[model samples]
Target: MSDIAAPRSSSRARNLKGGGRNRSGQTNFELYSWLFMRLSGLALVVLVLGHLFTNLMLGDGINGLDFAFVAGKWASPLWQVWDLLMLWLAMLHGTNGMRTIINDYAEKDQTRFWLKALLLTASIVIVVLGTLVIFTFDPCLDPHSTLSVCQ
Candidate 1:
């Protein structure tokens, strides 16, 4: 039998040359994204823990929760800022994580494009609405408001 060599596929050849050429030439985009993920994750842990401690461990704890409780909390600029940071960080972190997953799993370019578009739209809407609610929230806005806390 004569010795024979198998031909290398184009993909195998590309792999041998290192996969750096396939990038879209965005300088340090992935590096920034990776750093953001780590920093945001750490911030989220601290924010979430503080939020839980305040809501679930202070005062009457779970029994103290109600509309009036929320109104009182939002009345303070400190609490409002804390909650706003938590909301924005959580939403952005989740959106970025989902985008990474879509890029990894969605094989079709069209599918990936649409998925990311939808994700961005949803993230924007939620962030905008949440921000508005946090800033515009007024417990005493309505003169006819029935809430005892509002009075």
Candidate 2:
């Protein structure tokens, strides 16, 4: 018999890698991140599709989308919360994906660190601004605004 092991089947090859066994000092960050990507992607699909349907198919369709329509929609607490959730999930999901890409492509530790730092800073800025806009939105910015919400 040859000293080298025989070629294994796909299942056997997969079993070679550690499966469900927790090794000391090994964090499960990657696993959790992978899971989060899947869950957030599913949620985003639902949120985006619902938003599109509400905006394009309901009411006056595409023509109804004006400043007043936006003001009216944002005036509701429910729509505010919905938009807030969508903004947060989309930002986080996209950031996580970009982080993964940086990790995979960047060769040096310093390069990875800088790239991730930039990504994190940008993500934080966007999420904070978006959340603030969603919660603090005022449809009646102008005193003479004709929007019904303004009245």
Candidate 3:
């Protein structure tokens, strides 16, 4: 038998590099994205906890939640702004996380492009609709409403 040995394959050979490097070579976008995820996650924890505490722990708790309860909360400018920030941050964080997942998992260029396009479109639509709902909300807009709060 021959004494020659077969060459070993490297794990590095199977490792795939992502398109995380900026093509224009102008900025470390991936690094920023990484940092954003960490910071935003921390902020989200606080924001979400505060939101839950305010909505569920204060006053009558979850049992007091209703359309009028929501209207009362939104009537306050402070609550409106708080909710807006929460909405924007949560949507952006979720969208960015999904983008990273798609970039890492989708191998086909066309597939990746289309998937990202769909994600971006959905994100924009949700953000826009949510913002509109938050800002344009009117609890008394109904003319035939029966709720005393609406009156």
Candidate 4:
């Protein structure tokens, strides 16, 4: 063996200068976040595929899409729930990914904090608005409506 001692292990090297173990008392938030990203990503794939197939492959296809088409689709509670889940999951999944990016690239604590705050605010607003639109959509908003649902 050489006279020089081997380098310290990474975990030991990160210890406090006073030889004390550096325990930050942090919880498993990162672990849960990672798990959520994976689960939501899988869920989003299924949801998006279902949504695309339903909207594009069924009925008259893309040519049939219009305000009336949307009205008909949203009239069903099943479609409403499907779209709502898609909206929420997509927003949350995207937000989580952005949060990870912010944590990785943002150098200053204040910048990170503000970026996260903005992200949260924007996400909440989008989710709330999307949910409201999905649930409270008025398909018969037109004053002159002869559609069966309007009757």
**Global lDDT scores for all candidate models:** 0.87, 0.87, 0.85, 0.87
Clashing pairs in 1: none
Clashes of each: 0, 0, 0, 0
lDDT of 2 by residue, 55-146 (tens): 99998899999878878888788888889999999998999999989999999999999999999999999999999987777888889998
TM-score of every candidate relative to the true structure: 0.76, 0.78, 0.75, 0.78
Model 1, residue 59: C-alpha shift (Å): 3.5
How do the residues 14-51 of candidate 3 rate in per-residue lDDT, one tens digit apiece?
23232343434335777888888888888889889999
Error of 1 at 126 (Å): 0.2
lDDT of 2: 0.87
**What tens-digit string does per-residue lDDT give for candidate 1 at 8-94?**
566566655655543333356677779999999999999999999999999999999987788988978899999999999999899
The parts of candidate 1 lying over 4 Å away from their true place are 1-24, 146-150
Q: Give the TM-score comparing model 1 with the true structure, all chains together.
A: 0.76
Q: What lDDT score is found at residue 117 in candidate 3?
A: 99
- CA lDDT, candidate 4, residue 134: 86
